[model samples]
Target: MTSPGVAPGLLRVQGLCSGYGRSQVLFGVDLHIGEGEILGVLGRNGMGKTTLVRSIMGLLRPTGGTVELGGRAIVGLAPHRVARQGIAVVPEGRQVFANLSVLEHLTAFARGGHGTAHAWTIDRLLHLFPRLAERRSNLGGQLSGGEQQMLAIARALATNPRLLILDEATEGLAPLVREEVWHALSTLRQAGMSMLVIDKYVRRLIGLADRHVILEKGEVAWTGSSAQLEADRSLWSRHLGL
Candidate 1:
């Protein structure tokens, strides 16, 4: 599903390579996410999953390769510039500001969501995440782990991005809270929100992602659809350590 007058996919990272200082992490990584499609990035810890996300989000500049959003080159842009291209992220570790209230966090970077008929406004976000609404007056440090994850997501949604990236989406959340987060993600997918999800729950990802990209030591180790992944359990056994 291409955006009007744009290409079919929301994101494309071709031969991506980057790292801190000279310690190269990502090595020629390649992947894509179509509009309204969900792509799961899976790998063991330190395999460059977050590095890829950081590269795409302009948190790190790639030493080689290209990053395209809606078919336009976005490599070497500033984080704000990349964000202006209608991208948002729920970074790993939540990164919630202890001083900010739930409402403050949500409104920090309010940009009416793109490519959606129903943009993610504060009211809409509150409705979507009732717990956040309940804790609207609470400080970020006051909320539980589940509440923080929801807040992080809500903060991103408030920007109304065309592509939403969630690093370690369900990490550290309670089982029930993870289910809640996943359920919300499923709803967003159905609502046509293109997403790149990184999570440890392989089984849940198999059901949620339209496609999967397995990163092994910062490289594209495997790429396939849910059906292909499910048909080959060896993928998990070998690459994911499942």
Candidate 2:
């Protein structure tokens, strides 16, 4: 079920199906992201974008299909176990703790005792998002939407994951703030970080992701390279409701 021309690389999700109770959302969704590659998930609202991510992260168990990371089956693993397999998620809502300071948020969730040379440290994360550095002593509730989003991303990176999943990378932020988030993503890509990014900004996704997958009615409707996607506006109008 791999998309044509997409190598099943770092992360591979095949025929993945999941739902809440009896109401199914994702319908055999298939996608893959290679090492150092960014894959964009696109669709109109309620097209199973979040469900797909939840399934991949083991937040929700799938009724069928398989999810593999680096060739290891991770379908039924607990959420934390899946995360320990080198995957981290920046969830859709930018869920930062209200009482936790920026510094605490970074340090609390950081994966410890595995100090590689390139492991993400607080210093490195601060360098990535200087705004977080300036607000180190401030509670997560005190930061603006943009700053919260940055903190969420930084917190995920603190895990030093091999693969990162971001649901709604830039939702509900000022245009300028969105750009800043995009810039940080670009920086991560340049550093050879693998990412699965779900964002509403189709144009921005096209510019950032190496390939794109469009979901419709809980299924993957189309998937192709950025050049292929850019050339087909009809795909947008049909699947994404652009």
- Score residue 195 of candidate 2 by CA lDDT: 92
lDDT of 1 by residue, 57-89 (tens): 888989999999999999989999999998898
| Per-residue lDDT of model 2, residues 128-184, tens digit only | 998999999999999999999999999999999989899986899999999999999
Q: What lDDT does the true structure give each of the candidates?
A: 0.89, 0.90
The residue ranges of model 1 lying beyond 4 angstroms of the native Cα positions read: 1-7
Please give the range of 10 consecutive residues that has the lowest summed lDDT in model 1.
1-10
TM-score of each: 0.95, 0.94
Tell me the lDDT of candidate 2.
0.90
The TM-score measured for candidate 2 stands at 0.94
Q: How does candidate 1 score on lDDT?
A: 0.89
